[model samples]
Target: MTSTQETTRPRDIGGSPGHWRRMRMWATAHAVDDFYQGLVPAAVPYFVLERHFGYVEASGLALAATLGGALPQVPIGLLADRHRLRWMSPLGISLAGIGAGLSGLVPAYPLVFALLLTAGVGIAMFHPPAGRDARRAAGGSATAMSYFAAGGSVGFFVGPALATPALDTLGIGATALFIPPAVLMGLVLLRHHDRTPGATAEKVRRHGTDQPGRFAALTSVEIVRSTISTGVNTFISLYWIRHLGAGSGLGGTALTLELGGGVLGTLLGGRLADRIGMVRTVQLGNAAMLPALWLMLACDDKYAALPLALLVGLISNIPFAVLIKLGQDYLPSRPGTAAGVTLGLAMSAGGLFMPLLGVVAGHYGPRGALTVLATVPVIAILLSTALREPVHEPEPPRATPSTTHDRHR
Candidate 1:
């Protein structure tokens, strides 16, 4: 592997129409998988309204989902690395959908929490294997990975856009309506996996020496970024409705715009990383976040704040896909583990702080919670300083047939 290998076209994976088709399928499945994750936050405000839950209680739901999603990922990653787990993709998505769909159907808070937790576990199960396959399909191209990452961003965007109207109309029970996409997408993925030759036993061989120090630093940066992202996602609607005196519709609109910007930002970051280098892209994104947060905080007018929300989201996520790809670069032998931590644990770990932010929101309102969030980017910027470009030693020429067969055996 070399820099050229990292930046080149997907020719390594044969660059066939079939390869790209697989990439598209995985990306679509990513969107469907993540939609449930996004739905938790979208439905949180309604949970507050209908159940009359306190801020801390509302945040607890987030914590349930976060904890379930974050804790088991590393082991799952290890399993994905050692075996072909094509079944996990569809099974995980179906579980995710089932859990999220049932969450709002019940009246008890404990049951709601448990359902969301189940949904989170499904999310945990989906990422490692899905990410491993997506990376293989991408042929190590950051831009290609961004397309996959952008799928999650799109899912997050669509969650609020669709959930808001439905919740507004049918109330919370509308969450049940979201179940079908996940099931249908899961079936599609299952059918594809079964039809594709060698899909179940394709091996991902170990490569290059691992760089734990750099990967640790990268994970730290991502943890901070995730905290900020989760805080905003969990609170932005409430911020608009309570502090800015906006209606629920506008509050939901603000969230939708922010997540929509995230979709664009993920795509832009991928392209930018291909040109400027991943570390620089990470630093640049973190640096841009300061002013974006400040401007968003300063806006007194709700409508005017909407664009700033978009800017905030765009700047905040510019490093997201880059971080995920760079993590795999840093630990080349463990792409599954890299994706697990970056895509699952580090990403969801931020939700662990939601209860604390809820306390802040309870004390001084959503603005105060957001004000606390403004400090996170500075920390992310400092952490980005510790990241270095990973060196990829060139791979040996193709092995002989007997060598390949023996290795496979």
Candidate 2:
């Protein structure tokens, strides 16, 4: 090809040219999309207060949101893998925000359920394709992927902070305020997504070997960890309110410390993964969980629980990004499918067990519910020991001027 002709063709969707910039774009979109998810739980209290939803009814809302997102993800991931649909990211993120943001405006229980379901579907839509793209940009760097994961952590932290005041002063109708960020971020992602690159056919083929045993084990580990984490998130505030006689402000403060610890844990896990390898990092997180849980339980003082909450959050979340990356590596031929299970099914499936925990809490109290969480990490630690890191060839060097045209062809 002539020099000008070669220059005119867009760069192939392979290799790590401007990788960091591309990852940041995907991460920013991730943060925006997940912010809506974080809003659902935070809005539960308002629903009970304003809409007069009973415990069962309010829990149903959370269930609807979870089912909507979790059920559709596998099919969406399959479709994304087959089509590599570039438009999914923008459309998914926007739909997610709109559906979630509209929840407060609806009066009837049925309408609120429908809106939150749509939001969940939108969240599911964004994850598979966005994860695929982010992996391409990250070039197998667990640390970089952690930074991307950290964006979601930050968004979850920000969601309640933004939503509480709006709902407090303006009432449920103020949910409309959340819509603009979704629109803005969707437009921003739409502008750059097509320009972003994806994995080459060769790279995908090289690591295409499937390991079903390892995948199943990894998934089981996630289920255990997710179950424990979700239980803590659901009951930790109540623990403070009931056991410690803490006021509303202190309850919120406890949750904040937990989430803030997650942010720190994510960053730390990624760095450790890169240094000690993925399996060991997973092991480290699992091992730490028991002690953290013990510390939180032993502390009776509200002020003492605050710091333990941070420790528990860090231990629980440290393996998150590493697990996602490991799942992808294990099923390289089916990264989208892997993302569907790891990010969608495995994580949200844990929430399904909450009703059972509620049963436990009812009979034994929230402290008993939390006490059950302590044993889950032991299962995870044993499972982590069995995980073997998937192997692949080293990344090839980027094509230089002397070989650019040849490699492009």
Q: What is the TM-score of each candidate against the true structure?
A: 0.88, 0.90
Which residue pairs come into collision in candidate 2? none
Q: Write down the lDDT of every candidate, Cα atoms only.
A: 0.83, 0.82
* Candidate 1's TM-score: 0.88
lDDT of 1 by residue, 187-215 (tens): 99889878764432233336677899999
Please report, as a residue range, the 10-residue window in candidate 1 with the lowest summed lDDT.
6-15
Error of 2 at 217 (Å): 0.7
- Runs of candidate 1 exceeding 4 Å displacement: 1-22, 44-59, 106-111, 195-205
18-44: candidate 2 lDDT, tens digit per residue: 434546887788889889888888787
